[model samples]
Target: MSSSPKNAMLAEHRNIPYVAAGVTNPLQEFDLYVPERRNTLDTRPPPLICFVHGGAWRSEDKAEHAGLARRLAAHTNFPVAVSNYRLTTASTPIRHPAHAEDLLAFLHFLLTWSGPHTSTPTPPYDPTRLYLIGHSCSAHMLTSIFLQPLDPASDSASRSPTPSRSPSPPPSPVPTPDSLIPSPALLAATRAVIMSEGIYDIDGLLVTYPAYKTWFIAPTFGRLRSYAPWNTASYRSRPGAEHLNWLILHSKGIPW
Candidate 1:
C-alpha cells in the first residue's frame, strides 16, 4: 500500500474558534491551512477554500482532515479552512438546523475575520472570493444555509387548487429574525459550492437506504413523522444561488 504525497509548503493553524471560546460549544472551531506563496510580487489575495467535513452529521472533526486541507491549499495556492460543528449524540441531543446554523455563524466569522485579532499571526484571506466544499452531511448543511424555505404558507397555498388570496398582515407587525439567514454580502462572496456525496433529499434517501434512519437520520433529526421540512431538495434557493457555480460529485462504488 502506497501513501499519498504530502504538501510541505503550507502553514497550519489548528483549533481557531469561530465562536467565542468557552462561551459556546467547543466544536465551533476551524483549522486554517495557508500555503506558502511562490510569487512575492503577485500581491493578489487568492480565494479562500472552506471544507466542511462529514461523518453523518454526528462524527468527524476539522483536525481529522488537516492533510486534505494542506493538499487543497497547495494545489490551489489558496487558504483552506476545515470547520467543525456540533454533532448529534444521545447525550447532547442536538438536531437538524442547529448544525446548519453553526455553519452559517462560521461563514460570517470568516467573511469578517481580521488577522490581527488572532495570536496565530494568520495570513489575510480574501473575503470577496470564497469557495465552499462539503462532503456527505456537510453538503446538506451547506445547502440548508443558502436554500432555506422562503415562505412555508406560500408553498402550502400553491399546492391547493383554491384561488390564491392576499395574505393578511400580522397584527403586531413584528419582524422575523435574520440571524439564521445568510446576508447578501455572504451569498455574493461565495463563488462556488462543491458537494461531494451529499444527501439532497431526506425522503428519497430513506427510500433508498432505510438503514440510514437508524444509523444517523433519527439521531440527527429526532422523531419526525415526515422529513419534508429538513429535505434540502424541497428548499427554495436564495437570491445568489442562481449566480453561484455548483459542482456535485458522487462515487458509485461507495455503499452506504
Candidate 2:
C-alpha cells in the first residue's frame, strides 16, 4: 500500500513543518504542495522538488512563495516543497552554514517522515527522484552546504565562529547522520537542479563591487569570525554533483 498514487490525485498538502535544531519558531518550517493530478498508469511516488527562496540572505519569508509552490506542483505534477530558514541581521545575527544546515535538516525530516516540527504524517516521496530548486541567496546557501560532503562528526553551527559581542550562541547544529541522512543516496538519484540568479563567486563579488562588501556580505558572511570560503570552484567538483544535469537561470538585465 503506497500513499503516492500514479493516477490523478487532486491533493495539496500545505503548511507541513519540520524541526531544525530544536527551534520551534515558525521560520523553521516548510510548506509542501503536491500535484492534484498524476498519470494513472504510473504507480510511483512523483518526483520531489525542494525549493529554497532567496532574500539576499536576510529579508524574505517562505510564505511569500506559496503561489509558486502550488503552480510548480500543478504544472509539473510533482511534489514541491518550499522551506524557511533563520535570517541574519544586526540584531538577530545568524551566520554562515546555519541556513544550509536547516535545509539539510528539512531534507532528513522529509526522508524519514517524522520530525518534531511536523504535526501530520507526510506522504511517501520518491527516494530515487529528487530535485533542488533555489533562488538568489538560497542558491548560494544550497551550493555551500551540498557542495561539501557530510562529515558525520562535524557540526556546522559549532564550526561557525560566534560573533564577538552577540548575546546568544548560534542555534544548535543539525542532526548528525545516523542511518537517516538522505543526501548520499538521494543525490545519486537527483534528476536535475534549477538555480535561478544565483551568486556563484562570493570573493569575486567582494573584490569587484566594493559597496556590496559592507552592504550585504558584511552582515551575512562577515558576521562570522571564521569560515572557509566556498565558491564556484568548490561547487564544480563537489561530490554527487557530477551526475546532476543543471539548468542555471539568470536575468539579462543584471550584469554580474
Candidate 3:
C-alpha cells in the first residue's frame, strides 16, 4: 500500500476524545483514542493499541488514523493511541534513518509510559491483553521496532567518500538486528504486534520490482542494505498471526 491513502484516512477521523503525546519536537505530536471505557469509573487496565501513520516517513499525523483507532476500540474494546511524527515540507524528503529514529522514539516512549500488566480485570478494563497494532503505510512502525536493535544511531563512517561521484556500497549484516532496541528480557514482556499491508519485504520489493526502483524506492532505501528499515532480515522477524498475535490484513483482491 502507498502512503497517500493513509494520509487521506487520517484527515477524516481526527475528531475523537483522548489524551495526546504533546509535541516531542517542533513538528510532531501524538493523540490517544481511548475507547468508551475511559469514560466510566473503570478499575481495570485496557489493552493498548498503538497506531503509526505512513507518509513515506515524512507525512501523516497521529490524529489522521483516529477513526481506525475508534473502530478498533469499539470493535475489540482496547485503548488506541496514535502518534504524530516530525516532518517538514521544504526539502520534504523523509529519507531512511530519520523515520527509523522517529519510530524508535515513539516506541520507547510508549514502553516507558505504560509497562506490563497482571491479573484479569478490576471492573471495566481487561488485564489479559496488551498489543501493538500498525497498518497501511505505517507498517514500518513494527519494522522499526524489530530493526532498531540491530542498527546504530548513525553509520556515518559507512558513508561513501565520494557521494556525488559514486554510490554508497551495499549494507553488510555485521551489526545484526538485535543490537539496537530491547534486550531478551524486555522482548518477552511484549504481548503482540500487527502490521497491515506490511512493508516487511521492502528491500526485496525494491529489487524484485523495477517499478519501485524508478519511483521512490531506489532513493529511499539507498542502495541494497545501508541501514534501510525495509531490509529482509529485519522485516522477517515480525510476528505473524500465530507468533505475536500479529495479523497482516489486506483489503482483499489486492495483489499483495
Candidate 4:
C-alpha cells in the first residue's frame, strides 16, 4: 500500500524548467521544494525562502544548490526555491547588470509563475512573507535589486517610497531605476533579505584589488565608473534605504 497521507506530503518535483530555451541554449531555471503537509486551505499560504546561488557571477549553475534547497525545505518546513543565473566568463564575458537582470527575471517568474515555459500552477503564497537569500556574487545582485531606486514615473504605490530594504535593528541611517523594474505584486509582498558574503562596495573592491580593475571589473562592468549602479556607495546619497528587514552573513578572512 502507498504511504500515509502525512508521509506522502514529502514530495519533490525537479527540473520543472521555468523558462523556455532556444534550440541549443539552456534557459534560466529554478528548483522548488514544496512541503507535503502544508495546508493549502489555510487562511494564509506558506512563506517562501528563495535562494540565489553564487559563482562569482562567472561560474556555477543552479543544480549545484539542490542539496541546499532540499535541506532547507525539510528543516524549515517552508517551500524553498533555488535558482540559477547566467555566468560571466572569458569567452562570453557578461557585464554587471546582466546577472542582476537574470535574477530579476527569475523573481518575476517566481512571484507570478507565468513565464513562457512555467511548469506548475501558481502556488498560493503569502506575498508579504517572502524572503530572499543570496551568496557571493548573487548577494551583490540581490542587494542591487533590493536597494534600487523607485522610479518617479511609475505609480507611487508600486514601489516603496522608502528605498532601503535592509532588515536591521534600528538607527544608523544610510543610502536607481534601470532595465529591472520590479513587479507591483513583488514590491508589496517582499519582507526580508539575507546576504551571505555579499560584495557591496564595488569601487572599494576595485581599489583593494588593483589588478582586478583590468582583469575582472573592467570585463564585467567596463571602464565607465558612474554606470556601475551595483556599487552600494551609489545608494548612500539616494533617499530610502531602510524599508526591508536585512541580515548579512559573512565569514572571517573571506574579504568580500
> 3 or 4: which has the higher TM-score?
4
What TM-score against the true fold does each predicted structure earn?
0.82, 0.73, 0.61, 0.72
- Backbone clash pairs for candidate 3 read 10-64, 149-179, 149-180, 149-181, 150-177
For candidate 2, report its TM-score: 0.73
Candidate 2 at 61: error in angstroms? 1.2
Query: CA shift at 75, candidate 1, in angstroms?
Result: 0.7
For model 1, how does the per-residue alpha-carbon lDDT over 1-256 read when each residue is reduced to its tens digit?
Answer: 0122235677676667788646655588887787778788988887899999999988988878987887788788898988899998777767666788789989988887775335644445888899999999999888877776537575652131221143321111111124457988899999899999988777678877888877887777654344655656666778767788889898886432
**Whole-model Cα lDDT of every candidate shown, in order:** 0.74, 0.64, 0.49, 0.62
lDDT of 4 by residue, 1-256 (tens): 0111223544554444445444222436666677764555765668889988887677787668877887887888787877777677877766667778778877766775532224644574454568899887787777777665334345342222232243312211111346555666666567788999888766666666667655555565555333234555344322333467888999876665
TM-score of 1: 0.82
- When 3 and 4 are scored with lDDT, the better candidate is 4
**Per-residue lDDT of model 3, residues 89-112, tens digit only:** 437555554554555565555544
Order of quality (lDDT): 1, 2, 4, 3
How many collisions between residues are there in candidate 4?
Answer: 11
Clashes of each: 0, 4, 5, 11
Please tell me which predicted candidate would have the highest lDDT against the true structure.
1
